[model samples]
Target: MAATRIWSIKGRLDSVINYVTNPEKTDGGKYTDTELQALADVIDYAEDEAKTHNKVYVSGINLSPNIARDQMVMTKLQFGKTDKILAYHGYQSFLPGEVTPDQAHEIGVELARRLWGDRFQILVTTHLDKEHLHNHFCLNSVSFVDGKKFRGGSKAYWQMRAESDKICAEYGLSVIKNPGKGKNYAEWKAEHENRPTVRNQIKDELDEIIKCSYTYEQFWKILKQRGYAVKRDVKYVVLKPAFSQRYIRLKSLGKNYSEEAIRQRIIAARNGIRDLDKPKSDYNAWLNKYEPTKLHGFKALYFHYLYLFGKIRKKETPQRVSFYMRDELIKFERYQKQFRFLYDNEIETVEQLTIFKENVENKIDEMIIRRSKLYDKTDSKTEIKTINAELRELRKNLRTCNNIFIDAERIREHTEYVARLEKEANEPQKQQIKDYVIG
Candidate 1:
């Protein structure tokens, strides 16, 4: 089966181009120097890198694969439409082990051709590094022919889905016949992994409150006292938690936590009966399972930051993280990439990382000169393609090295923050140790 998704890119067009064209799903790091300044506009390196496929699977419509970035940027400049939304990025993913890489690329090319080939330039790349082979499309927001912007609305998505289904049917690939409303990636992953979700959190809190409540009125009153806004007179008992933006209906939390169910649960509670079916979880078990070990250098730094974010579990006092960093905590996967890149490269000291980046940059320059010489000397397409492929790989490496530097700076800053947090969290323990020693 093939599923399609699309979104707008409001940032620099080059970043999206660079990401989609990344030769392999490799590279991670931070900002440094003027190069680092450009890295600031990169939306999510982890997500982009994960979706990057083999260069052989990459194709461009009305543009060259090697110079797709320049052509897209030039088109935007020609139309005088470089502000706000820069491009529209869409993807078509197929079920795992269902189709060959060449077939996937062909399907992607056909999709882009039939959809926007007449009006716009598109770069279609089939990424094979992931479990499911997927195609990534980078479309210039401005049309090359008429200077018109592509509108990506509900109708656009419907058309995309319809076209993709038609193409999939032609290829004899499975298509989602009655696709229902889909959840966002995060929500889907959370549900799949049985992770804590806002809905589950609400249900858990309600369960606790129900045990203490004897009547429906008392139950809502207690919920309000706990900073939850409730609209009890509504068709559905809608509740808005202080930390959440949208109101959640009581019926949505499943039949067990429905308004009538909650009332019955409260009645049972008053009659000396408890809902023992509500599964209890020991949150501290995660901490207990983690073995404390000493780590030095970049690995140690990344480990502690992840630990502070509640990603890593260890038996230790809870450290205070800045309220602003709560969002960052949800992005531990990105942090993990940063850590893995450093680990894989054996990047220990700042000096080592700087030297590595410089080496890659120097190599890229040498490869560029070599490629230029080959283009001038040889009329052979094969030779030119081979050199271009080599150049793409080297360029991807250079991008990763640059990101490593950029992320290293941020990592060091968080390292200091983590140190301060640890010191604060450890102050009581240290005081107790000192008192016992004196006694």
Candidate 2:
């Protein structure tokens, strides 16, 4: 069982972090040297996990552990130097039905007052429904009850852990063993935390279910029953199983059985891959011979880059509000590029789209001039050039974003369009291109 042990003492916020991490201190907290040392050791043990010689690494530092690991930041503002340290020593201990830590602490502290005459102001509360059961206790070094300072957690620390464990046993909760000391904190962390990732841990469970099916047909049915998707082809099969909303491809289930091989087997066992394949015989043969689906997906990457502005935030702590704005702009860019590409690609086939697009740009220019004519006198030439360039550049990107079968013939067509455009970018056509490049 794991735990969440949190403890701290306080003074100046800067001083506390400096002393704990970089240990040495600078100013006044009104506490004497003896009081300071006692508090420092408690912090030392809590932070070092009680090991002067051992190093341990624990994580779940929200916003990154480096910033969130030390919890005192929030509390320091509540109470500062000259104010008595008021910390809530809490933990998610692996004990069930045990008395709350505060109750236990209250009983112990109260008894100490009766026996040793050490009185202090103490506050304790338990929090449930979390990863573990724990409590928070706020007590001053000196008794607010009787104004007496009490020594805490040095030699008396192990006594607390042991006492808590013994108390748990009496209440039918399991007693936890302290693996540290007997084994220092750092060494214990090294011993644990070597566990596997969730994905790897599920591998065995997946194999157990999947291994039962011998052939692709059997596997396909079982997979479908379990909500997995099967894609069929003449060569092999593709199985996509989703786990926790993320999909995984069981590309190679067995040795010598590639996804394509399985897909084809599964399809042949049922019908064939022809149903999903494109018609047009020669092109079909070309795809089967040279352009596989794997080859086609790479062309999609080119399309992905067409509208990319490459705007990066690049900040230490990114202002989260801007992420969605950036994403929306990217999506709008994609929409514009795709619309233009379809409009241009249809120029020869539909002819109407080309005329419609020209009219739309003409209207946009008319509207801009009519609206801004008041500010004119200036050669709005620069502004006109800028907007036209924006239009042309957007169109150019659309041509690049096409995700289609890169059949050698289709590939040749794109190659020619690119070559002609590149050649046209020279001297004579440069002015026409520049007309559109102004933006």
Candidate 3:
């Protein structure tokens, strides 16, 4: 089965064009990525096809060969329009082992012609890099014959899918009758292979935190503490977990995991509604058990270490005693390393920690500037390889510096919290502080 999706290209049009028309994949103007029988006579033929059909005259076509002329032409057409939509990028992917790359490309070109032949100028390129055969369509927003722009909406998308399904049927390929929902290729591939996806991992973490949280804000804060980057937009709540490079939409998780659903669950829990599916232990009963108290610097470090190493439970410990189970001993050794790091860096005071953080920040800034210059200088393949190697080393150092800075910040925050607990004499305030700290 083949699935189709369309998206608007708002900026950086050149990069997209270059990627889809890279000579290495296209096999030197063979259009090997596509099933098109007509071989391209020149490089970046798909881009050239799009540019030839462009109605608006654009400058610097000869001067800037690296820039996507088609995109530049589209931009010129959109100069006076109120709508800022530049171009539409679409993808048509087929099931692995179902169709050859050539067949996929042929179907893709036919699909585009059927869908937008009369109205839009489209360049269909088949990409053969992935497991499944896929086609990329870089369609001009404005009509070449007429100056009208392609107004895409729900109806247009439905039409596109219908057109693709019809083409796939003609090619004697299977069609997905009920495509309930859609996921990006990577997520789909991961799921198809029965591998644990980043989304599933994030959901597991979210479920754990949601079980303990009483409000949406608290849930978000807990996720942040667990090192998830969260961004709330008008329609969806997106989360990028630690070590992940991409964000997953909450709604895409499923009906039970949408933003509204999560909020409802939080409200239900607050009103004493219990989710029978979740285990009782998932909800931390000792959330408010710890009482934060001001101590001398050494005492603060001692308690922090105990808490850090999980020597003391969330609740009070009868007395501080050191035990050496194999795991405990290993953790103690790690704690000793951290203690040495603090001592060696002179991070005993908040002021010193702040200065150390600033230095790390400055180093990161310097690396970033150096990386930018390297990228700008990369023209040849050898230069690119050399620059990438340097960038990788810089990235490693940056990550180490960032981890250290985060650790210092966490220590400072903990110290400040303890200081605040000492200043608050009211019983209720102290209880609130304890609850905030332990949770």
Which candidate leads the pack in lDDT? 1
* TM-score per candidate: 0.43, 0.22, 0.33
Ranking by lDDT: 1, 3, 2
Preferred candidate (lDDT higher): 1 or 2: 1
Model 3 lDDT per residue over 261-378, tens place: 8898888888989767633231122222423273334334734654543422221222112111112322332344444455445455556655666665565455444443543343
Give the residue spans of candidate 1 off by over 4 A. Answer: 1-182, 195-250, 269-272, 275-292, 304-329, 347-439
Each model's total of backbone clashes: 7, 15, 2
RMSD of each: 14.6, 26.0, 19.0
As for lDDT, the candidate ahead, 1 or 3, is 1
Clashes of 2: 15
lDDT score for residue 136 of model 3: 81
**Which 10 residues in a row give candidate 2 its minimum summed lDDT?**
55-64
Model 1 residue 114 CA deviation in Å:
12
CA lDDT for candidate 2: 0.37
> lDDT tens string, model 1, 166-280?
7776554666543442223345455576554556557656877898898989998888987799887988778987656678777877889887788888999999987456454
Point out the worst 10-residue segment of candidate 1 by lDDT.
40-49
